[model samples]
Target chain A: MYVYNDFDETFVRTRVAQFRGQVERRIDGSLTEDEFKPLRLMNGLYLQLHAYMLRVAVPYGTLNPAQMRQLAMIADRWDKGYGHFTTRQNIQYNWPKLGDVPDMLEALADVGMHAIQTSGNTIRNVTADHFAGAAADEIEDPRAIAELLRQWSTDHPEFQFLPRKFKIAVTGAAADRAVTRAHDIGLVVVRNDAGEVGYQVIVGGGLGRTPMVGKVLRDFVSKADLLPYVEAIVSVYNLLGRRDNKYKARIKITLHENGIETIRDLVEDRFNAIRAGFGGYDQTLLAEIEKSFAPPAFVTKATDGYEAARLANPAFRSWTDTNLSAHKAAGYAIVSISIKKHGATPGDATSDQMRVMAELADRYGHGELRISHEQNVILPHVHQSDLPAVYAALRKADLATANIGLASDIIACPGMDYCALATARSIPIAQQIATRFDELKIEHDVGPLKIKISGCINACGHHHVGHIGILGLDRAGVENYQITLGGDGSEMTTIGERAGPGFSADDIVPAIERLVTGYLDLRRDPSETFLQTYRRLGLAPFKTLLYPSEDKADAA
Target chain B: MPPRFTPKVVTANALLDGDAVWLTEDDHWSPLMSRAELITDEAHADLRLLQAKARASEIAGAYLADARLGADGPEPVHFREAFRTRGPSNYPHGKQVETPPQT
Candidate 1:
């Protein structure tokens, strides 16, 4: 994790003071609601359905134990006893008091964190792969670029008020864990034919109402020119992006209106003009940032204990099979602590659970933790020999669920339950599905499934990329759910195709159960996953199961 | 025949606590839906909304929301408003923490 310098500390302290004064002004009738709305949003405070929600950014999904413990303290003291980890790899306190938000910001800054740039129509938090430096397949650590982008975009004079909110993600691995293809600006590190490491910059990919994959504007941008290159793209967008309509203001819409080639030409022209302005300071800064991410020293440890423990305990073996990922170090493993316990709200963690995770990080994970975009906690450097002990600690806290990629591990946004923008409730739907699936004990049989639910078309749940996507909507003043099939968020990414009419809230869960059970019958075997089967056979079969009346009429 | 506007309540989140509150008949903000004044007439509803909006120090986003007087009191006609009166479905918190779950 990158420690804050005196300059960064001063910068955050100043923002806290500014926001505290702004809050006081609003209280004294000096700043009207209209005037304070943008200011509050700039600090990541949003008035939701029940209370004010505060979103805190965990930069690049990296946090030390002290920061994690401070987050727990904030949750317990200022807000509710728990916080919701979002798909953006950040945490949201759903019941924060408006007056206490300034104090909350001060507490966050005390731990070298802040809520600035977490919201508003500006460059949002820069996300990276949770297993960035620890992954075996990574070309290089992507956090260096992610941090550079974070510093450059934060309070940038020209890009602060973009046409719409911009999102950027970077992934260093061969596998697409960061969902880079779905970001407004996705950076995939690539090694060229000449053995040069550079970024394959993809633009215009987004997942709101209009879901579209990004186009590759550049095949490879060297590290030296990356900052200038990205700035040029944003600059071109700042000039050409639509501001007349909020819905049509994203860069994706810009790319849709003007062809990719023309936009690429504009960006390249701008890049040439402004490349010298960077003055080569970004490269030196990047080198300094890279030094902060040096891998921990490897300690030689025998794996006989791990093998014996796994063989002795079936539950431990199952959890290891489900939640463990390949680590770059021989004796180390990446442990994804499943925050989505069965039938619970997907990403919520109580303050006690937060403290437990912090302790686990300090004891077993070299005092480091990562938050996955899927809303799970990641101990990026857990040793293989310590897996049994970690599993025991997690189980005691009800955080040890052996479901990572299964149907029970669902992604859901805080829908109508908390968000003001949501049209229907998403958490209940996710909870019902997970609970129903767990009761049947066939999730492991279903195997490698992704069910993502979004409350509305905002796609905060990343439903656009789920194998089975459930979108909640308001139909005739009642909650309705629409199903989509064949969406994948990996390198072979595609937007899901909608299956016909929507189902009522009461009918949606059962409808999903039927679809999955039907999938069990239609699959070649348990070995073939949901996406593969959906690809082999089109939506015709699943559609039949989801809307049986339509299939019945066709049969008649 | 002209369509009748449904009964309504002026509702907003409290500026300090951010909890949902409704304007009462006595010009005070009440956290309980039962205490809310249901404005039946359109003109009166607009006036009440304006009055609520003027209380900037007390509220953040004031607007008229659809409601109807039921056997008990003002009942939310839409699910979203009902959810606002209660709390999130996943947890027993907010106003509904004390009130029994509605069937």
Candidate 2:
């Protein structure tokens, strides 16, 4: 894991002190709610339905054992003994008193972390592939670039108060685990024909009321010009993006209104102008940041033992098959620990579980842990020989769930339980569906299906991109859910369409069961996943199952 | 009704206790008053005092929107707003009393 430098340490400490002063002023009645609200939001404090929620950024989803331990401590002391890891790889505490927020921020700063820019209309925490350095298919580590962007974007005087929040993601591998395409700016690290490293720049991608797959602005931007190029893009958007309406404020809407080609030309024009000003600074900064992220030296080890253990234990084999990925280094594998336990709340980890993860990261995974966009934790560089020990520790902590990309491994937001904006409960719906699927032992049979839930149209859970998306809404004060099929969150991204009529909170699970059973019945074989089948036959069959009465009524 | 501005009783945090209290009509702040004393009775002296305090506190203050009175009762004002109108601990509302000179 990368250690914080003096500059990084100083920045976070100063921010914490500033926030503490603000909080004291608010308490002393020198600041009004309207005056204090933006300041608190800038530090990622939200006034939710039941209590004040504080979101802490896990930068690039990377944390050292000490940082993880500190998170556990924060959960135990300030929060409700648990933390919810969001899809953006941030951890949110549902309950925290307004007075205690300064203390909470101070505690975070002690561990080189803060909640600054975690919320508000500034550049958000830069996300990257959780398996960045370790993934076999990666051209280079994306976190190095992500970290550079983080340093550049944090409180950048120009971009601080944009029309709306901006999100950026980077991916080093072809698999796109970071969901790069669903961000305001997506950078896919690639090597050109001459073997020089650069980024395939994509712009205008986002998810909300309007979801868009980012359009490629540049085929490749040289590694040296990354920051200046990004600045240019953001600068253009900041100046031109809609301010009249909050709904149409995102860069995507701006790009839509003023054609992508025009935006691209403008970005290029700006990039050309500023490229000279950033001359040697970007290279020097990138080099400095890269030094911080250099991978640890690994001794060659045999994976024969790992294969032997897998053969001996079918459960281990199943887990290895689904939860493990090929590592860049031989004899090492990237292990993804699924936070989505069958019937438990998704993306939540208890204090004990967090401590165990910290311990496991220290023992078997180079003391580095990563929180993935899919709402799971990754032991990035675990030696194959140490797999058993790590798995055993995880099992003890109730963190060893084999379902990683299966149907039961669902991504859901906090929903009405915590969010005042939410219309219905998403967590419970996801829990019931996961539990039902587990009971049926049909998750594996269903194959890799992404079932994402969002409480409302905000799309915090990214329901728009799920293979089987469920959106929770309130109809006359009753919780109702709407289903969408044939969605995907990948290079081939497509927004899912509404299946049919909405189902009551009670009827939701049954409706889902009906849809899944329908998929199972209609599938050519078990090899055909829900998404594959849905894509092959379109949404007709699934829609038929969801709205059978409607079909019958139409027929009659 | 063209968005009638009701006679609202606003409260603010006490410098010592951080409790919401009704601002009394005699330019004095009363500590720990009930929601009924803050609102509902337009003719009540306590409610009138609260209203006066609320107006004065508007210089630089935050209203706690989430804090509301119980059902079938008068609306409660925030505690923070009260303290802003009246000064801090070193300065008390009654002790630092300045009677306006007759014009």
Put down candidate 1 lDDT per residue, A1-556, tens digits, no spaces: 6888798899999999999999999999999999999999999999999889999999989989999999999999997789899999999999888788899999999999999989998999999999988999999989988988988888899988999999999999868899988988999999988999999999999999899998899999998999999999999999899999988999999999999999999999999999998899999888888888888776779989999999999999999999999999999999999998889999999999999999999999988999999999999999999989999999999999999999989999999999999989999999999999999999989999999999999999999899999999999899999999999998888999998899999999999999999999999987999999999999999998998887788799
- The per-residue C-alpha lDDT of model 2 at residue A157 equals 98
List candidate 1 segments past 4 Å from native.
B98-103
Any runs in candidate 2 off by more than 4 Å, and if so which? B1-103
Candidate 2 lDDT by residue in tens digits, A161-254: 9999999999998788888888999999988999999999989988888888889989899998888899999999999999999999999999
Give the worst 10-residue stretch by lDDT in candidate 2 chain A: A45-54
Reference contacts reproduced by model 2: 0.02
Top candidate when judged by TM-score against the true structure: 1
Per-model i-RMS in Å?
0.7, 13.7
For each model in turn, which proportion of the native inter-chain contacts is also found?
Answer: 0.86, 0.02
**TM-score: model 1, chain A:** 0.99
- TM-score for chain A, candidates 1 onward in order: 0.99, 0.98
Per-residue lDDT, model 2, residue A419, is 70
Candidate number with greatest DockQ: 1
